[model samples]
Target: MDLPRITARRSEGGWELEIAGLGPAYVKRLSDVSEHGRTLMQAAGVTGSEHGVQVKVDLGDELNERVRSATQATVDAHRAQLEAAAEMRRTTMSLRGHGMTGRDIAFILGISPQRVSQLLSSHQL
Candidate 1:
């Protein structure tokens, strides 16, 4: 049977993690955690927090390399999403500039007219 892969990302205080096929979680660095929480995180490799558990993964060189690769992939995916959204907005503005109505843009873009209006209002374009 196949299981979901866990992705790790570097965040402000620590790491954000997402389990494939499941929801996401965040884990702060040991230094950022409270003294009591840090102790638990060290001893058990994790400690519970408001959102989820903060984790410490002490890994061998090979595992560290794998984690780094996964993290990069996650970051790259997020960047791609931002780029795509920007492209979509550009295309929408171009179509509007050509005198296409919101309903026309929505039908052409396969989105609801309300969503078209929202996009226009959001970007103020």
Candidate 2:
């Protein structure tokens, strides 16, 4: 991003904005994002012609690590689903090659005959 990043931490009364070169500034809770940006700009001494800054909210180290871990778990679950689908498609093709009927393959894989037909017609599953 082109804007400078400012760290915001929850504090008594409102929040604490830590600007890189300029230490920390305390601000009362604002109603909207733009208002917060405007207040941050004034505290950081940004010129009127310049745009607003980027604010990074800090919820503490433990909470941040939990958020990251949850995000990674979601990504890993999606990847596993994709891999399982691919493996099912490969197994279906292999069974069909052994002269097995769609109905028989469906019974073996616990899926419908229509699904077996679909797997046979396309490379993706």
Candidate 3:
């Protein structure tokens, strides 16, 4: 199940946190996020592990946003990396079928000759 998230962003002089359904605004330091979140959750009648809150905080806006963006971008990059590897594996097979040598395939694909041989051997598409 998807869990609810609490967003804490850097504000003037400190950090500001807010819950969607709750009316109160919270301001505190980074270290005390869990305690403050717990307190607010209790106040808002959000009890137990079923309703656990996910806190999204960074080291203030400038630093935090960069980290958050980089974090998500890394996930996206990893997915793209996997997809590119699969495409390369398929392309390697197609090249080998077209009477291409391992060394030639490696040079054109920018991979090692040994990698070309491995990709040629594996049929796990």
Listed per model in order, the count of residue pairs whose N, CA or C atoms clash below 3 Å is 0, 0, 0
> Please, what are the lDDT tens digits per residue for candidate 1 over residues 1-125?
22223345566767655443334456675443344443433454432332344344445578889999999999999999999888778788888999999999999999899888877886794
Residue 55 Cα positional deviation in candidate 2, in Å, after optimal superposition: 4.6
What's the TM-score of every candidate structure? 0.53, 0.67, 0.57
Tell me model 1's lDDT, rounded to 2 decimals. 0.64
Ranking of all candidate structures by their lDDT, best first:
2, 3, 1
Q: How well does candidate 3 match the true structure, expressed as C-alpha RMSD?
A: 4.6
Off by over 4 Å in 3: 1-5, 19-31, 43-45, 48-51, 56-79
Winner on lDDT between 1 and 3 is 3
Task: Give the Å shift of residue 122 in candidate 2.
Answer: 2.4
Q: What lDDT score is found at residue 84 in candidate 3?
A: 90
Worst 10 residues of 3 by lDDT: 44-53
List per-candidate RMSD values in Å.
13.6, 4.1, 4.6
Tens-place lDDT per residue, model 2, 2-103, is 776667778898888776666577777633434665566776576551566666778799988998899999999999999998898899999999999999
Which candidate number has the best TM-score?
2
Q: What residue pairs clash in candidate 3, if any at all?
A: none
TM-score of 2: 0.67
